[model samples]
Target: MSSARENNPPAKTGAARKARPLKTRTYGLFRWLHVYISMFSLLIVLFFSVTGITLNHPDWVFGNVETRQEYSGTLPEGWKTGNQVNWLKVVEHVRATHNVKGSVADDGYQSDEQQASVAFHGPGYAADVFIEMGTGKYTVNVDAQGAVAVMNDLHKGRDTSPLWKWVIDLSAGFLTLVSLTGLGLLIFLKKIRPAGLITAAAGGVLVLLLMRLAS
Candidate 1:
């Protein structure tokens, strides 16, 4: 008679054998994404990081913090017909005369108290116009808040255009993807994953504790 051990061979684990390759593919995908996304976001990451430091310290004066100029000019005759001021022409004249820029502020166009005020605001620039009702003459104050201020303003999205705001949102999305992929890649690193996860957890806790203490 054949030996009992020889009569029944061990059962083959075909499904389990297939699972190993699938797990490897998953790990490879994460690694690929992490590497490419990090390269792609490198510039954006650096920009935000450097600007973050400058933003945290508002008192750090760099470049001309502000430059003020006063301009006085007479509007064209067509701008004012008695008390009914042709506000459109008035605004245009100021812009054309002084090379003023930026979109008009929300409350920038107001006609009250026998005078009209028109204002424009940009990332780090401002222009305010005051026109006397009787005469078509006007005075404007322009303020330039320099390059550093402009960078800070861009970081905060104070008065950027719709396109630039979209850029900010897209950059944020890319950063999130890079971070998630990095963490995913770490999970696949069986040799270092346990220590890596513990370090990450501890770092997060430290940040939370710092925030609480700061507040």
Candidate 2:
């Protein structure tokens, strides 16, 4: 009986076989998630990466031409009430007359100088209005930065709308998901796991070294 058991090995047990199928299914699910999520986020990743390069080297000129326009106008006297400047009327008038597109970033009145300044900011765009509180005479200066500047601002979520901020957050979540699933898939590949982990560690160390050098 001992010789027969040694020769046959009693055929592999069901419990061990079941464990393999569960592991394989889990691995397959993670792989599927990794592939699809990566595909969906590819464009977003490319945009951010390219913008990152542009951001890091601001002096790397992309011929970003800034065009400035100056216009002189007179505002209605009713736009101001006593010592206070009516900001709402001023902004509306600027938007209607000059076709300005941006949110008001600053609105201040200098009582001594009898002047008021209103500034608007948007992605790669700025508009400033200086007004003589008494005469209502105003000067508008509008600056439009080139396309590259706009894209960079969008990537950084600088002066962007809340909707765009949401997009950045969602993209970050997707990237996190992709990374975790990718690491999970590597665990199932025994032969490559050691090399993969080493490579990942090396990448992390390189980033840390670069940050240290930068500081």
Candidate 3:
């Protein structure tokens, strides 16, 4: 029996067989997630990366270029007789006439003996309306920023809409998924596992050091 067992080839072990398939599945899943998620977040990553550099040095590219304009117009006659300060009518008229772009700020309206003022704020944009309560006359002053400034504002989520804020959140989630899946893929490669983990650890250390230095 001993001689027969020695002569015959060793039988394949059940555990080893199962382990191979499991490992393959894990590697496949990790690779699939890593590749697609990286691709999906590519544009989001690039946008944030470039914008990060631009944000760090605001004056480098756009040089704070802003266009200022003034416009004058007459309001509806009914607005004065019934209610001199019809907020909705005032905002709509200014937006339509001058093609204004912005959300009305909370402190947008103020009343005084002379005139009432309304302020609108948005990413790289601001528009203010001055109305004479006695007469239906109004003036609009708009300050529009350059492209670089607009991009920077978008990156910061400053004066952006709620929808855009949701987009930023989803982008952050996608990027996190991509990073975690990439790290997951390294676990299956036995040959380079140690080196890869060491490199990752070094990266973490480097970031910490940089932050320390910055502080």
TM-score of each: 0.84, 0.84, 0.83
Native-vs-model 2 lDDT? Answer: 0.86
Per-residue lDDT tens digits of candidate 1, residues 1-215?
Answer: 46876998767788755455877998899889889888988987777777799899888897737999999988888886666778778878888889988888667788865788888888998889988876767899999998888988888788779887887887898899988998998998899999999999999999999999999
Q: Which residue pairs does candidate 3 place in steric collision?
A: none
Which scores higher on TM-score, 1 or 3?
1
What candidate 1 gets wrong by more than 4 Å, as runs, is 1-20, 80-85
| Candidate with more favorable, higher lDDT: 1 or 3 | 3
> Could you tell which candidate, 2 or 3, scores higher by TM-score?
2
Summarize candidate 2's per-residue lDDT along 1-215 as a digit string, tens digits: 99998888866777766455788899999999999999999999889888888888877668578999998899876787886888888889989999998776433323435788888888889888999877889999999998778888999998778899999999999989999999999989999999999999999999999999999
Model 1 residue 14 CA deviation (Å) reads: 20
- Write down the worst ten-residue block by lDDT for model 1: 14-23
Error of 1 at 147 (Å): 1.4
Task: Estimate the TM-score for candidate 1.
Answer: 0.84
> What overall lDDT, based on C-alpha atoms, would model 1 receive against the true structure?
0.85
- Lowest summed lDDT across 10 adjacent residues in model 3 is found at 77-86
